[model samples]
Target chain A: MSAPLFNLRGVAAIFSAEMARTRRTLLQSVVTPVLTTALYFVVFGSAIGSHMREVGGVAYGAFIVPGLIMLSLLTQSIANASIGIYFPKFTGTVYEILTAPLSAIEIVVGYVGAAAAKSIAIGLIILATAAFFTPLQIDYPAMMALFLVLTAVAFSLFGFIIGIWAKTFEQLNFVPALVITPLTFLGGAFYSIDMLPPFWRTVSLFNPVVYLVSGFRWSFHGAGDVSLTASLGFMTLVIALCLGLLVWIFRTGYRLKP
Target chain B: MPIISIAGVAKSYGSFTALHDIDLDIERGEIFALLGPNGAGKTTLISIVCGAVSMTRGAVRVDGADILRDYRATRRKIGLVPQEIALDIFSTVWNTVSFSRSLFGKPKDNAHIERLLRDLALWEKRDNKIIELSGGMKRRVMIAKALAHEPDILFLDEPTAGVDVELRRDMWGLVRRLRENGVTIILTTHYIEEAEEMADRVGFMKGGRLVLVEEKTALMRKLGKRRLVLTLAEPLAALPAELDGWHVELESGGSQISYAMSDGAEKGAAQIIQRLGEAGVHIKDMAMTESSLEQIFVDLVGAAAGSQP
Candidate 1:
């Protein structure tokens, strides 16, 4: 008999498969982020915060906390999603997903959703750890959560794009390391964009990660060097752009066909 | 109605064409085998029909629904068992199959899931992680996953390539059961024996073009070559002048005569037997060896390649 139509059930299948794999290596997806966040708090929060004054009416430790959380969100989301997809490509298992009845949208939502969930989880862990170092008050918990999830989803989609583009394992890791890592660091993860001169501030504004970090930081401390509305607008556009690109790639079956 | 209609399908990677203009009509509830060598565009053809690959020029309809224009509807009508073994190693066999069913938007049906697992001889391994299974068992799990969705058409791409004999038998048996249940099964394989044993219709592909598509038995009878061997009661000293016109060879100390036939139109076999009788060589016994599906494939494909520009 012919199979039935597609719907949320497809998303669940894709998402469950993805989540099962990420859970397979809890040490990497979960423990590594926690440990790295702790290290950041120690080195950047205490060491750097000890000497440097606060930029936005918050302690250096608390100020860097938002950036650190955003960094974790962006990196983990991309890494988990990219590696999750890359393994299938290498093992030739991606054909299973591609040939299934599920639409390209379902595949993206499943993988990107799982990646966002992991990143959000790790981001929360970092946020909790930051609390141990410095007490911070949230201005809007709802907006923070929304921005956090959105950032994860957006970056995870971008990571999925990179995963699809990468033909080898080395290429998979290269983009996240060389491109994503450096961009996050320079996006004011450890500092504020206001400290830079006008020319550099304008340049920082161009970095998508800057808007993501700035918007997330604004949600947390109710203040940021860049305009919060502008950051939100940029993040929304980035999310749409990445989503559109992913859908197009999936529709075209680029690098996915036999 | 035909379950899948591939009309003038072609695929290309930049300037290189992977699949050329091709047309195929796969009826519902039959096992159709696509046979070809490596890079013969078997996978590309299946991919296009399943909507996994974009076609450069052509359209495919699954149960009358266009693959590209009405993808969701067409996709829901088929189940694909890809060549690659791509199960999440950490997931249990049961979970993987069940998840695959849900992917088709089917409601959770534990009984259906259990039945598919049982049919594939994977029920006992349901709780085991995919990584823990052997290669053959993993292949069975792939079959189970494909059947989970209960689609009208099931596409198996090299289902038994690395599987063991027993598993292959079990898989074939399962495919037969699926066909009996009215599932249109389209399978691709380099294993000629698989097509010979399981296919109702055979389609031979060469260099992206479908060279021939016919009933398995008809193709064999029409194009299948045969060798005739006759054993004489006494050894012959030399070749007879009357039998010189035949493509005959003497074997076993000149006691047997062998002749090859390209098709049924050749009456040379009867002539050979008549010549032996007329030559005062009493034939003790004789046997005919028919060409295997592999032989027919090689001959047809080899000829196609030789004729290529």
Candidate 2:
């Protein structure tokens, strides 16, 4: 009698629209990031690889590849989802979405799902570009794919919340620029936390990006600063927290409905 | 049962109330025009019924389904043309309309979309992106998008505000045609003539409360006050003491005097004339005008405003 409650059409509509928007701004969303990752590989992989020896038992160029991919993945996942949701709010088109026959879950999945998918695709592209500078290997390919998806989905959900919380475009960029990017850089996207002093290594654990990058790095080389179990468990915990927050936002209509 | 039943629905944001005890039952296939000024809870009421804004108290049922429990059913049953231009500016008009239909879980029907675009005169601009369209064209795309889903009820909140005369007439014609097709159209408008021209029933809202709702003809017949304008032979310096009992005012450099008579036919006008004669007031010519919905609305709102300190 409920008539299959969930609406695939509604979800597909939103998903396709978001994906279409990503394609429309391919240069800014996909091409530019892939290019940026290529530049990073050139500076850190080829230029610096000449002088640097092997660290963590892997070549310097290859060691940083997973972390670099994680860096782009995290930032893009948040960026795509946050901007995806924020643009609707900015243009006032969010009213149409709010009024449509879509459940909050369906809407979230549509937007966040498309954003995660886009990030994963771009992340893979960056990894592919990195292969040109250095050799790459994945000891646990399935786990790598799994962690890639997990990180993308989790960060995209976080970005979705930012989209809802942000009142202005400047506010939308605040967390990504002033918070996430800085945290990712300090989180050991380019270097190992093991290289830091003992106190700094302990402090690095506090940055949430450390777990994400380390977890993702473990998937590639079977090694990380934090234990593999801890990284995986931490990501799952963060995903749960993000999901809980989203459910609350949708239920309370915080900054979404008046 | 009424198609849409707003039973004791009220909304308040923090300390300020937006809608207060608004209970309305809109019938099927009728053009219901809610007339109000800015911030009169017209948009609030519309938003609540659409489930875009949650009500702080009471409930709304669309087609007998509770809005809270059965939002999907209710949402699928109605199309809303918001007061603002709310469309994906990057998408083509055709894609926007088609996407709206899909959002309802309705199957793709190109024929239906083509027909809606044609009816709204958006057929030629079908492939054009919404950002490229002119203001009026964008409004037409909004209408086309709303109609794409084939909803049982259509809520148009200030659909023609700032629209050109030609588009307004076109919208009116489209509304009439939709009513003919048995779509329940509830529209909020500040334009009294639009209500007078289109609505079968008219409702007046003031200060977050619905003052009255009645059939347009019945309302005009019942509360339609008359104004008798008298062109005086000479401009009066001041109103005489005899003119104090009647609801009269001097205007146009005091050369014309207007009085609010009790009925549309001005039955009490004779008594007013007699009082004027007692004051030795000379009249050059006289004319009478019946109050339109605009005046009734103004009076209702004015009375409410007058009651507030």
Which tens-of-lDDT digit does each residue in B21-111 have in candidate 1? 8999998898999999999999889988876777899889888888876777777778888888877787899988888788778889999
Please list the C-alpha lDDT of all candidates, in the order they appear: 0.85, 0.90
**lDDT (tens digit, per residue) of candidate 2 on B1-309:** 999999998898999999989999999899999998899999999999987898899989998999988898899888999989988888999999999989888889999999999888889988999989999999998888888889989999998999999999999999999999999999999999999999999999988989889999989878887679998998998888987767789999989999876644355678777877888988899998888888888888898888865
RMSD of each: 3.0, 3.6
* Residue pairs of candidate 2 with colliding backbone atoms: none
Q: Please, what are the lDDT tens digits per residue for candidate 1 over residues A32-94?
A: 888898898899888988898676678888888888898889888888888778878887667
Q: Which candidate ranks first by lDDT, i.e. highest? A: 2
Runs of candidate 2 with Cα error greater than 4 angstroms are A1-3, B227-288
DockQ of each: 0.53, 0.59
DockQ computed for model 2 against the true two-chain complex using alpha carbons: 0.59
